[model samples]
Target: MSAYMVGYARVSTNQQDLTAQRNQLNTLGVPEERIYTDHGLTGTNRDRPGLNQALAAVRDGDTLVITKLDRLARSLPDARDIIEELTKKNVKLSIGGSIHDPSDPVGRLLFNVLAMVAEFESDLIRARTREGMQVAKAKGRLRGKQPKLSKNQEAHVVSLYRGGQHTTAEIAELFGVARSTVYRIVQRTPTLN
Candidate 1:
């Protein structure tokens, strides 16, 4: 029997365009029945139903087509892991931007180099974000997460707690805050304690 080919496409949000990705595979003559699409889900999620369906449907020695490696995954590690799984299954991965296969020695060398470069880029992004946050804090721009309760509500919650007028759960419910916040208040403030 001939090797079966299936395609997977994804869009970050429901509003994003998946048509281009789908069309790329369609241009390669992939049938509608063999194409799976996932819309409005984060690329970071592993439990993607459409991706799972495509993986499940492909048999040994089958080909899995994606318009781009990034269309299949967000993170480089995620892409590498998915490709590794496919390789172990005797499945062929065809990336539009790639004219090589990592299973071969030369291709393996190139793939590792590219993968390491992508990982380096991601690390730089993380470092830049941390530095940006530190600079923001120095400039007093990093205010942290805003308190769910306003000053008036916090004072009211404290007053009620001090007077023993309400339980922790009740205070949480009344202020629409968390029980942990109530506990933190009662433990930190001498009047509430």
Candidate 2:
């Protein structure tokens, strides 16, 4: 069987673009159609569909191409697990156009170093984000997801629901809200005996 390159790209957030990674993979000689990608998925999450597809596409003697080690995996154990799988399948890993040779001691050491760096970076990002959120919460600037209805609006919804003159769908339509929201409002309100 002939060997070919299978490329994988990933972005941790929806706002991040995959164009640069795709371009890099293309420059590495991977065909456009052979590239797989995941959007809005964290590298810490191992259950990405695009990564799975890319791994499945590779065969013995084939190369799995990634723009960077972090793009393939952000944690050291995850990176090592992926590398082990590729090694078991007799497949090579090409990180930024440099093919990794697991058998070589130097190569293994370098790969480990890169994996540790990726994991460290991921940890730093998470820690900084948590700190920022905590600061925001303390300053009352981190009010999460405001309610869809105001107190008055909720009371009106409950009254309309208790009146039993209108159906849930009709009440939702009148208030320009969902039936589920109406149900929630009614569920929380105390019923009058």
Number of the predicted model whose lDDT against the real structure is largest: 2
Candidate 2, residues 36-154, lDDT tens digits: the string is 99999999999999999999999989999999999999999999998888878888889999998665667778888999999999999999999999999999999999989999999
Report the C-alpha displacement of residue 107, candidate 2, in angstroms.
0.6
Model 1 deviation from native, Cα RMSD in Å = 4.4
Please provide, for model 1 over 98-187, each residue's C-alpha lDDT reduced to its tens digit, 9 standing for 90 to 100. 444546767656655665665566567779999999999999999998877776777777788888978989989888889999887667
Models 1 onward score TM values of 0.64, 0.83
Clashing pairs in 1: none
- Each candidate's number of clashing pairs is 0, 0
Model 2 spans with C-alpha error above 4 angstroms:
1-3, 13-16, 57-62, 191-193
Cα RMSD, model 2? 2.6
Q: Give the TM-score of candidate 1.
A: 0.64
